[model samples]
Target: MNTEQPLKERLKQILNQNGHALSFEEREILLHELIDLHGQAKEGKNNETEQIRQAFLHNLCHVPQSLTHETFSRFFAENIKPADFRALEWEMPEQYFQITEALYLLRSHIETEKVFDYVTELLVHALRSFERNGEYKKMIELLQLVPVPPSAMNQELLSLRAQAHIHETRRVQHFRQLLYKYLFLQALLIFVAFPILFVKAENGAIAKTIEEATDVEMTEERVQYLSYADGLYWSIITAASIGYGDITPVTNIGRIIAAILGSMGVITIGIIAGLILDRITPRNF
Candidate 1:
């Protein structure tokens, strides 16, 4: 009887079978058996070891089964090479893609942060691959699959996210609408600040610092308290981050308010500038 041939054939058949119906324990058992077989084969023949590895990966890719965290931890420990980490920086190998896809499918079943970090790193590389191919929508879709930790996000991921948003906005023809929203927010901040400043000025919180420059003597009736128009103008200038120094805040509360407004204005301007650059930049790059 050709027992070895039959065993090899049966293993191949199991590899071809979909393991989605199998429980985690069942999958773990099968995985352990395969690893043992591969390890035994590795002792005498390199070709058999390679063949078994390829079959194992092929089976892993096709099966949507979830394995236990310990199984995955062991699997990665045995399989992951230094080359696998290097591949993330350059062209991603097809094997890596398959592995990442398989892990992504079982993301919800993952319990350990270590296993999840592996999945996240792989997916980030996959996202970069999509970005290189100008597949922004696909990149965005893949990103939405996992809840990537904020700590793992580098500048590369942030750039990918921005590109995805720009591509989506361009596709949906909502660029103008987005611009309008930003402008509305800016205007809203200005108007909201206006009311607060007007109230402060009404309480004698604001004063004109250049009273002598205007050759006006300070008096009870002739005191140049900031007017409503001046307060609104100050709010506009403060939000624009263009402090002209024509008016000044006398109270500590008023200075604090101005400082906050100035910081917000700078951030808003930066956002607007980034939006404009994104709109004007060519997509071909």
Candidate 2:
């Protein structure tokens, strides 16, 4: 029975059932409806759209289920892209715009195969967009309708490119934030804390430790000792076993710090090493 069916006949039936097709009149109706929905969502009335979207999503989540939102699975490949749910971009709430953009980029990628290159493009696009002091808020509108020629293959490719770019940029930003936090914490260890913590140095450290003529110089110095950064770095270096010889603690209490940091270094290294074994490990990129 399936083999006897025409491809367009089967697809048309499926799309119609999934609410994908739009006659010119239907497109007009959707345009106005989307504008209204956008306004309502902005006014915090997305309960209706949320309900509609969720119902379709949940139904497809069943074991014997759909291949798209209401039809095929999201990952299904086809010649032309399925019309995006957020086809009416301007009609969406501002907060929903980014997510809508993300989905569009994703769907576009499904239609096109240039996933990695598209993502790199988005990163650069975001950077240049920011540098130009370009209009950030309305830029999303420009994004959705990036003028694919009427050809099905070209449309599919551009959509995919746009989607890949968005996904990569978002992932990169999230990763960048983690790195920034790591660096900030690292800087705190290097510049702010190591200078103050000291224990009477023995061996090569003794001459330099004695020469400082200072340790815990003021009230700020006293407060810094209580901070976690003090122990964290000591632990990091000790754990890495890099005893860099430069940043070790000097004062009596500082030497006491070395003991704690040294022990911490051991535990931290084990944790970092174990993290590498997981399946969805944090991307270093």
Candidate 3:
């Protein structure tokens, strides 16, 4: 409840403007009660502003009950931490959602006072926390619900929105770059290294003999020692770090090449995993 007489008068005027018609006696009774409660509000109570807002909310049919200043003070003392704004328990999703909606409501209607400015600051804090959590899209979505403030605050919100977009874009680009690198390496193994290895193996002689007998190519024909499709499959599976061992190199040189490829695969996969974690993890608030 607001103790200031002028603010009480302003509230009366605002109520009348919103189509509430209170008799003179009724208005006097309500204003005096609020003033008395405001007088009783203790020192060091953190939720006096919230109590006043709740009074307005009750009259506006937004809340089930209007909280007294003392009740609000006690509630917050028990439930809220003075440090970071996290609730002790996040199990009640609907309660959190309702609080967000209530804040939006307050932002839209409340006059630009200290209380309203504090609400705006809380919204900004929430935005920063969401950004740190890597919930960029969610942060943007929540920001959209906030009514535009004065030019300066609105610009600040817009800047935060832009920052979220830039980070998301960078994340996407990093993923695409990693993907391209992996695919290029896979292609090199399939198209260049695999063909050379296949042609040098003893299997190449047998395959060449079969090709000549079948007249698939002339005696001068270049033999394809391994199936190109099989080589591609092996490249994909090996890079994925899932060697099923169905098809393997038979020669010593081929085994050495496989060892090198397996090592490269391990290092590349580790790098990719680290990049993904970096993208998802939240930065400092």
**lDDT for each of the candidates?**
0.59, 0.40, 0.51
Among all windows of ten consecutive residues in candidate 2, which has the lowest summed lDDT?
Answer: 79-88
lDDT digits (tens) for residues 42-95 of candidate 2 = 325344344333323222222112232322323222211222222211222232
lDDT of candidate 1 over 1-285, digit per residue (tens): 755675577567666553346655565566666676675553566555555555454444333243324565455456643224422322333444556555654445554575566665666666776777776766656655544577877786778777777786675456657778878876876777554665464454343433456766433322235666777788888778658887766555566777877888888889778877665443331
lDDT of 3 by residue, 35-72 (tens): 44445555554465335333433332222122223443
Q: Best to worst by lDDT, what's the order?
A: 1, 3, 2
Query: Residue 52 in model 3: shift from native, Å?
Result: 16
| Candidate 3 Cα outliers beyond 4 Å, as residue runs | 1-98, 102-121, 131-153, 201-285
Give every collision pair in model 1: none
Pick by lDDT: 1 or 2, better one:
1
Cα lDDT, model 2, residue 6: 47
Which wins on lDDT, candidate 2 or candidate 3? Answer: 3
